[model samples]
Target: MTSAVHYKTAWEDPATRQAWRRTAMFRCAALLGWLLGFPTWLFAVVMTPTWLLVLWLPVLWVGIWYTLLAMVAVTTLRGIRRVLRVYPWQVDIAEVRAKKKGSTQFVVPVPERPEKSVSLGYGGLLGTGQHFWVRAMKSGEVTSAWFAGDPRYVGVVATPGPRNLLWVAQREATDSRMSPRKRGVSPEARALARAAGARVGEG
Candidate 1:
């Protein structure tokens, strides 16, 4: 949990934006999952006569499809609500105390607000050396967690360190925020600056 005094929600801009884009992509796969369900169901009916198999197939598909839909709705709304917002302070860091189920989930503890410990599963333990395909019930060992967005419900991300999307975005933002010449300013801006210099020299 490398929650720095500078972190808090300060990295929210990039975190939420990236989260939305990733969530959109994930939902696209969910759409595919939905479409494939028909064939998969047919296959189950034709190739597997076991009553238990047929009974569970649809149940599993519906569960996964609905879960993905819920995720899409949640992330999209959160992104819309706080995409442009930035925080310049600090707070308690969230913890990833669960496994990733094809996506990241978080659990942010809140014990003092006269309410339940808020924030739920998102990102999982990184550098855990565990194969992503392995469906382990446990999250292995979570050493660090970095979160962005609202701490209450919309904690958009919980990436473990050395792989923080917000950190990556921050670096890119830093590069972009450099001097105009270093960042390769637009030609129009250069022209305007030259004209301003000419006027100043004439004076």
Candidate 2:
């Protein structure tokens, strides 16, 4: 039998939580600024023919679209970097268990009503209905367990292995229990899993 290694999920520790809060606050502020500024800038561009001919509305729209896309891309990259910086530990998974239906509640900022909204709220707005519970073991003993709804993250758990037992189980669970609409994982996620050395089933 292969030895099991322990893994710690993101935002599990106090330091991680603090780091996440800082980064999240910054991100929210950036998002709010963009939300407020983008429309105003677009309106100015549309109304002011001196900036660009009003006849070139299509070009202006395309430019705006690409600019928004770039902003999103930059923000995503920064978030990824921040996450990596905050949680520097390499997670090693021992086993994974899949749930046909699972739910978890987490907190998120309500941009429109930040002052009125509570910081900690309920519901799985950011998560998928499906869940995978993963256990990481160290020295033949379990250390930590994490819940994930995204197949890609689940793939990360299944990556380090003497054998990919979790992948087999995941495939079986997905096929037998999931509805047709939610039967398969996304191609992108599957590809990512494969790249990370995790075995993934066909979508």
Candidate 3:
């Protein structure tokens, strides 16, 4: 008897939006470093005199390698910390339809974009669909959740918490039981969600 609820994506929240913006910028910088580090080092090597190469080439190579490695390590660690630091966004609970084995399925529309949705898959030992929230991230990425409450007002923790692999496995098991259905919000939807979030700051 639970009807669908219309709610915005977490990105719609102002604080969450700003935090994700910082995260995105950090990631972009990391990616740029990964792409340009080797080429920049190679260029420096090529520009050096042959005599200098004989004396410092190995040192330069080792230094560059370690520098690049450190950049990658720091970027990855910071990204993880950023994600963990951002609090989970509250979801507007939409339709809580029952699936196989008493599991439940729901879709939270990515704010201002009707075309995209964040689908949640819930699974637990109770078979009452009262625990474990799971959602797909980018390809090869995993996300999971823990939830509380019931149909009227349910609370969800969407952060990629500890025990990620375990939650992912539980999600996979729950998904396997689901009928053929699409998962995750689309890229376009995500972009729109970001745009909408940005507008909130502008206003």
Candidate 4:
């Protein structure tokens, strides 16, 4: 079910960009990478069997972090380049697929192909990380999609905030490893599955 109230986002402007830069750099890009990458590396090394089996695990582990850092650099540079160029803000209606403490996920209007638009999988927040860890909550803000035009700023969240909310937010990709069968397209099916799983666990 979709929320009846729609949120309007702030327009991309100087203040909005400032807010975005601080959040992106300190919270997500540089700091977050180092914090997560180091711990992950340590965990892998400490784990007894997993690393031993994957013999070259140490080399691979360092390489993984290097790759992540490189990606962070490239993405930052690209976004900077995009910001330099002017693009029309394409504000379109998006379905509030998932809502979490700090982030919101939604499907943007595929103007060219309406059929390709996301109308499923948002039945509930099961896979959306609603209760999971997210930094956006600390600031009482969310990043929907940055540099992609203020899509109503954030189609999913209609909360009152900066008019340029989109300037600071980017739609972080979601985990889609689960099979379609497990995703459960409709809400009722998902509910039933959860109930069954609960009953099984009780046994």
Candidate 5:
């Protein structure tokens, strides 16, 4: 698992309204850019003839405007993707330490949070590195597992010592059969939970 996972700020809190607001802002910005383009271009064209030395200024301005517009569109789309019901996920871990005979203590780590994603593709939009598809409950058992959409391979990170943490991604089609009990909530419910305690119809 890669440590540089790019989680959006909007996803950190379970506020549907806020998420919606952010999405709406993106749309509004997109609209504003579209509406402003024609006028700006027309104005630039009109001004160019008045100043022969600046005849090429409009071309440069349009290039810069389009470039900025594209960037805004990309950022908006990325923000939208981050909050997608099918793409977002949250993973939590719980660790336990027990004392045994001969003054020996054993530590065990258990998953406490939910696992989710935007799509069923292998690796995240960014690389998820190598991961595993744990088949059974046997300790130290490991195997390779492909993401739902993509066929690329990623390494599954697991707990190192006792009471370690490991949260892996799931395949879309096989999530029902592969995920843990509580983690197997319905897609809608999972989306809510993954959003850090968001609930549907709670507007």
Candidate 6:
């Protein structure tokens, strides 16, 4: 289901080359590889009896180790690709509400479940770390292609357009504390609140 109200962000600007690096994928893979070394060594030691009894067991273990190492290598390669590609993505915060028979219902966008990253190192063949980035966008009318799995949010991507701009806000404080009517409220939320006959001061 889609929300009828369409909102755009004047503040949504393109991301820089550095922003993608902060993504969870890069950090997770680095941690995974560093952490896996110990367990891998333990597994090899525990399987020694089997490796001695059957040559194939040793070979299989070696294969598994190498495969993991290769995964780490692949993850690093992907990270490099991100640095090179450096696409621009639009970030916007939105709230979706679905209408029921007569009343309106607030729809909670699906939350992202944390993922466990597996290290890509196994003994003997260039084992490396592999990190996977889960969905970062959701499918929607304006953002279907970049749409990730969580239907609650939508992030649109744009090519590196000719123009690059940054918007910054500076508030002039009359007093340290904002009046109850002048606190933190998003423009979109304020608009919605006003339309529903509610004041737009504090959320």
Measured against the true structure, the TM-scores of the candidates, in listed sequence, are 0.40, 0.30, 0.28, 0.33, 0.29, 0.24
Largest lDDT belongs to which candidate? 1
Tell me which residue pairs clash in candidate 1.
1-144, 104-122, 104-123, 105-121, 105-122, 105-123, 106-120, 106-121, 106-122
The number of residue pairs in model 6 that clash at the backbone is 16
Supply every candidate's count of residue pairs whose N, Cα or C atoms clash at under 3 angstroms.
Answer: 9, 0, 2, 7, 17, 16
Residue pairs of candidate 2 with colliding backbone atoms:
none
Off by over 4 Å in 1: 1-16, 43-92, 98-137, 160-203
Model 6: per-residue Cα lDDT over 1-203, one tens digit each: 21211113211222333433343354466457655755765677687775464654565676566556545544443433221232222233222222222221212222332232111111122231121111111122221112111121112121123111111011111122543233334566344333323233444
Colliding residue pairs in candidate 4:
7-158, 9-152, 10-163, 10-164, 11-163, 11-164, 143-169
Cα lDDT tens digits, model 5, 1-203, are 32212333323434433534554675567556766776776676777766653765666565565556445444434324333333222222212122222121112122222242221122222111221212111233422121111111111222221111122222332244443323334555444334421222221
Error of 6 at 133 (Å): 7.4
Off by over 4 Å in 5: 1-17, 47-83, 91-203
**By TM-score, who's the top model here?**
1
Q: Candidate 1: global Cα-lDDT?
A: 0.40
lDDT of 1 by residue, 20-131 (tens): 5675565567667666676766676677667768586766666565656545444454343242244322232655444444433444543234254444443233322232
User: Candidate 1: minimum summed lDDT over ten consecutive residues — where?
Assistant: 194-203
lDDT of 3 at 43: 83
Whole-model lDDT values for every prediction:
0.40, 0.35, 0.37, 0.36, 0.32, 0.30
Distance from true location, Cα of 147 in model 4, Å: 8.2
lDDT of 4: 0.36
Q: Which 10 successive residues of model 4 have the least lDDT summed?
A: 194-203
Candidate 4: stretches off by over 4 Å: 1-12, 27-70, 73-77, 80-85, 88-92, 98-105, 110-203
Better model by TM-score, 2 or 4? 4
Residues 151-171, candidate 4, lDDT per residue (tens digit)?
A: 211122222222323222222
Q: Give the per-residue lDDT of model 3 (tens digit) for 148-195.
A: 111111223333322221111123222335432124434443333223
List candidate 3 segments past 4 Å from native. 1-7, 44-203
lDDT of 2 by residue, 88-175 (tens): 2233322222222332212222223333321111113223232222222212233322222232222112232212112111342234
C-alpha RMSD values across all candidates? 16.0, 18.4, 15.3, 15.0, 16.9, 20.0
Error of 3 at 48 (Å): 7.2
